[model samples]
Target: MNCLKKTVLFTLLLLGISLSAQTVRKYSNEFMNIGVDAAAFGMANAVVASTSDVNAGYWNPAGLLKLEDNQISLMHAAYFANIASYDYAAFAMPLDKESVVAFSAIRFGVDDILNTTQLIDDQGNIDYNRISLFSTADYGFTFSYARALPLDGLNVGVNAKVIRRIIGDFASSWGFGLDAALQFETKSDWQFGVMARDITTTFNAWNINEEKFAEISGAVEGQNQELPETTEITLPKLQLGVAKKWVFHYDFSLLTEVDFNFRFAETNDVFSSSFASMTPAAGVEFGYIDLVFVRVGAGNFQNITQLDGSDSVGFQPNIGVGFKYKGIQVDYALTDIGDQSAALYSNVFSLKLDWSLFR
Candidate 1:
């Protein structure tokens, strides 16, 4: 390998080591999003089954192994009750007859908010009123490589990504992660595989102030405080999963999978910290005429305590469907949670488009 290739592999390893500590940030404000419906993620994101399409970038870069032509995908979604949104653009091509390389950019936007607080009005009079706006955004880059091997029955792939999160007018933090998988084919009628993801990441941070905020709220610090000296939080993120399939005589197949996510973060005042709990998800996929498909799934949630000792908690159920025409396919997903005190547990909805180079 040349220097450039060596650099790529070494950086991939660094992403895997990011699992050491936990984080104090609110991942829900960033990662907890659905662009193609909750059904996609609810099922272990196993879209790698037949990768000749584009959504594979988010689900399984290994799925790229199945692609024979270039392709692109665009996805977007409305998340939670916070008026947040997510957008993604992905494209890929072959680096060689046997290998493929893919690139993608994802964005999370927290629209300006109506800040409300009490003011003195310079008249020594206190009054509650709407204040300034608040919101945040982030960016992620992924470089994935995959190939098919003729080793009897072994087919595997890996992906690495650089993730950065930024808050409104705050210092941004950079993170890296790793994802790997192996798939085995038996009689071409049955396919089985396992995958691991987000093996390393901080998930969130504790603070974003341009400078360290004095803990005493009235303490003076030296010039060293010119730049934002923020507190970084950590999160343990490891996913282990297995999937299987049943193929019909025609081009149709029925697939199912289950995966477990273990969090290493400790329960704390931070939001995403509550997700320190474990999550086990399972679902099935169905295809007809190699063009249309549908899937449904469900899973548990991580519970975190909030003020008044009340926090959001529970099991999440989801469903999704897909349609293919010419070389274009569209996907949709939905996740539902019952209700809560402060706000009724909200539902998440997403849509995704996949186009192949052959088109």
Candidate 2:
């Protein structure tokens, strides 16, 4: 740790704070309170702009585009608060001279819920609140193909995905979606990127053949009870971001980068929100001769209610690190909202072990 490097990193921290001033005076919500898959949520989710690492696959599949070789990654986070847990495993390999192929499986779901429904006959009867954990799960498998077209320094890629969700005693649904990403890196160190996801609205429905719900109709039971009509909402999400990576001015082993993102989508059980945006995130990594990395950053819209004493909330600080080995990669991240927001969160960890045949 050099003094000069620390000073520069501190300066960037100040700038991040200034950006925060402008982020306020907007809005807030609950799904935003629901912690994401990992502590990696620790940072402003600076993961997408990250390069040469497998975690990038989750944040931005296009990240695999800059890889010098083929690789695989696995990640899991123990969600302490809810039955929810996050797990993902993926593989990325170059298919041809200008194409890359990737495969991955992702899962996140609530465990069993207390099945406390009182039994009743066609005749109206009353029952006490029951207690038993019901079953539920959601998993999706995806394949992504990316290419670097030789078009005057312009790089582009496309990724297609399939998603599935299963509700206990309810109908399950599956659908397809696609994403596109484009980037540019010049003779200088400046780099720029743009991406769009969930181009198609993915849908799911409950109470079909697999799970049947008997409708109970009794004027005494209150209103025409239609076992919660199977609803439809768009999972179609969209986000756009730009990044800039700066070479170290003095510390040759270190490099720094900053990114800003704007997100838009409808509400879901996953994250409650009308919209989300992260602007001007900054971080610096003290690299140990290109073998290891120690990084820190701040800023991302967070629910202030998540914190205890503070009546204020929206975006917080994040810290993370990574270790890379031949055919093996590991990553970890941490987020701090403040002491007022005492609810501790789980850590997000991911690993990727891949092999390339025939050199």
The regions of model 2 sitting more than 4 angstroms off are 1-43, 118-133, 205-224, 227-231, 235-237, 244-252, 265-282, 302-313, 337-344, 356-359
Q: Write the per-residue lDDT of candidate 1 for residues 273-317, one digit (tens) a residue.
A: 544645666778888986888887665554646779896665566
All candidates' TM-scores? 0.68, 0.70
How many residue pairs clash per model?
13, 19
| lDDT by residue for model 2 (1-359), tens | 33333333323322222222221223111122223323235445544444444444445556666766777677776554534567777777776656677777777655544333333434656553433344445576667666676774456666676656554553455555676766566666555556565555334343333123332123124432344434333333344444454545533355455655544543221244566543455556656644576766665544454235554444456667777666555668765546433445556776656665335
For residue 51, model 2's alpha carbon misses the true position, in angstroms, by 3.2
Please tell me which predicted candidate would have the highest TM-score against the true structure.
2
All-Cα superposition RMSD per candidate = 10.8, 11.9
RMSD of 2: 11.9
Cα error, residue 188 of model 2, in Å, equals 1.4
> Deviation in angstroms for 219 in model 1?
15
